[model samples]
Target: MPGESVEYVVVHPDTPVGPVVGLFLLARSLEDAEEIGATVCGRALRTRAELSGFLLLGCEGRLVGPYFDRLLGWAPAGRVMPRPDHDSGNPFLDF
Candidate 1:
């Protein structure tokens, strides 16, 4: 479990065919995750030019927009991982 990672997926559901989603990769470091997220965002944009308006990659503590030229890092709000220890607002709760 030491090698495990956390993933955050962003999706847009306004596509003509269907919803388009971009995933924030989980790797060694947050920097690496940003790199991978950027790549996924690029691919999503390339796949559908219209998806530009619905793209956002979760980086650090804030969501990374596609227009960003640099990656920003911030303190995580403990909303990482999908396990019981990582509390990202109770998944079973409904507002």
Candidate 2:
């Protein structure tokens, strides 16, 4: 399992209407995915006051929305995709 990774969908669960933000991440486990997702979101909140109340809703193995199609277009089967760097700009904008 050296190169194994799973695709996860992370969202902000408390949105009044629905999750306006969706984060896609590749990680070794569900817990790792959630942590990474939360960390990324936390950093964004530091700069964007409007996102203060939002938090990482959760991470799930299933892909959702446009992220699914976007992944299929670029990610190869059974290959671990690279995780975004801490300073790699805003990932949320990519979604």
Candidate 3:
């Protein structure tokens, strides 16, 4: 019926424990569904897992590891220094 739109009725009346239990059950079901989906798409899941791990491990340092420094538009602290443009007319000399 058009009048039957989703509505909340307080069945518990007092402390409302039922709705809290229902929410926890719903969360568990969603977690299980994601796990099942991951198992079904294992190869694609591995790609995501590796990417997630790379992101976590790659940024664990205070210095911000090399993998992400370029992405953030900041150069990593010195190993091979980039010469100032005025010092070396050839840009390739930075390497």
- Judged by TM-score, which candidate is best? 2
Q: Which stretches of candidate 3 lie over 4 Å from their true place?
A: 1-28, 43-95
- Tens-place lDDT per residue, model 1, 1-95, is 23334355666779885665656444666676666656656666778867666545443434445433232233254332233334766544232
Candidate order by lDDT, decreasing, is 2, 1, 3
After the best TM-score superposition of candidate 1, give how far the Cα of residue 43 lies from its true spot, in angstroms. 0.7
Candidate 3 residue-wise lDDT, 2-94, digit = tens: 322211212232453321101111113444534433333343336665434321111010223476445646445532344346456644443
C-alpha local distance difference test of each model: 0.52, 0.56, 0.32
TM-score of each: 0.35, 0.40, 0.17
Q: How high is the lDDT of residue 61 in model 3?
A: 8
Query: Residue by residue across 1-95, what tens digits does model 2's lDDT show?
Result: 23323244455657787665565656666667666666666667787987777665554434354665666665666333644443867543342
- Kindly give the stretch of ten consecutive residues in candidate 2 with the minimal lDDT sum: 1-10
Alpha-carbon shift of residue 83 in model 3 (angstroms): 67
